[model samples]
Target: MQRKKPYLQPYWWRLLFRANGTAAWEAMGRGPLIPVPNAALTRAPLEVWADALLEEAPYELEDLHGDLLLECYAEPAVTDGTPPVYSRQVRLPGK
Candidate 1:
């Protein structure tokens, strides 16, 4: 008999970055020099979209390997009178 796969809900997207020089700028009060075009980053896979955000800096895919990191989740705005809640988790490539 085959085991059933668990149903995983697609939680809202977020970005995880290793705290470095360029990342520091985005973190500090430097303002967002590179504006995220839309909320697309959250929906796209990390490997596919992460590079675009790091375009101006020197970054390598391997650089992200085994590094302690910080993640930022762009919370969704609630239109109705409901409150907003954010989800977070430590995600590795190919869970």
Candidate 2:
């Protein structure tokens, strides 16, 4: 069976350098990041998409990998509603 050569998407080197610097190459000994175009990313919710990406990301720095992928889009901003507000754990006695 022929082994297919790894595909490093355009500008991935720059992104990886910015993300982990030379240390990444020294550690991993190989780079396998593939830039998924905006037209390719799924329309799933941000959190769900993030979880899936994190689970399957080939890069050691998942956060950076995810960010870099998102940055490829023209607009990486999230148009969802604000996150839920959580109240402090202080004692609120009203008995």
Report the number of the highest-TM-score candidate: 1
TM-score of 2: 0.21
Query: What tens digits encode model 1's per-residue C-alpha lDDT throughout 1-95?
Result: 99986532232323344343343311222332223334554566543444443442224343343222323334333233443233232322311
How do the residues 1-95 of candidate 2 rate in per-residue lDDT, one tens digit apiece? 99986543222111222242323322122434333433323444333434454345444453442123221222223233522121111111112
List ranges where model 2 is wrong by over 4 Å.
1-19, 22-44, 59-95
TM-score for candidate 1: 0.23
Listed in order, each prediction's TM-score against the native is: 0.23, 0.21
lDDT of each: 0.35, 0.30
Worst 10 contiguous positions by lDDT, candidate 1? 25-34
Task: Candidate 1: give the clashing pairs.
Answer: none
Residue 4's C-alpha lDDT in candidate 1? 88
Report the poorest 10 consecutive residues by lDDT, candidate 2.
Answer: 84-93
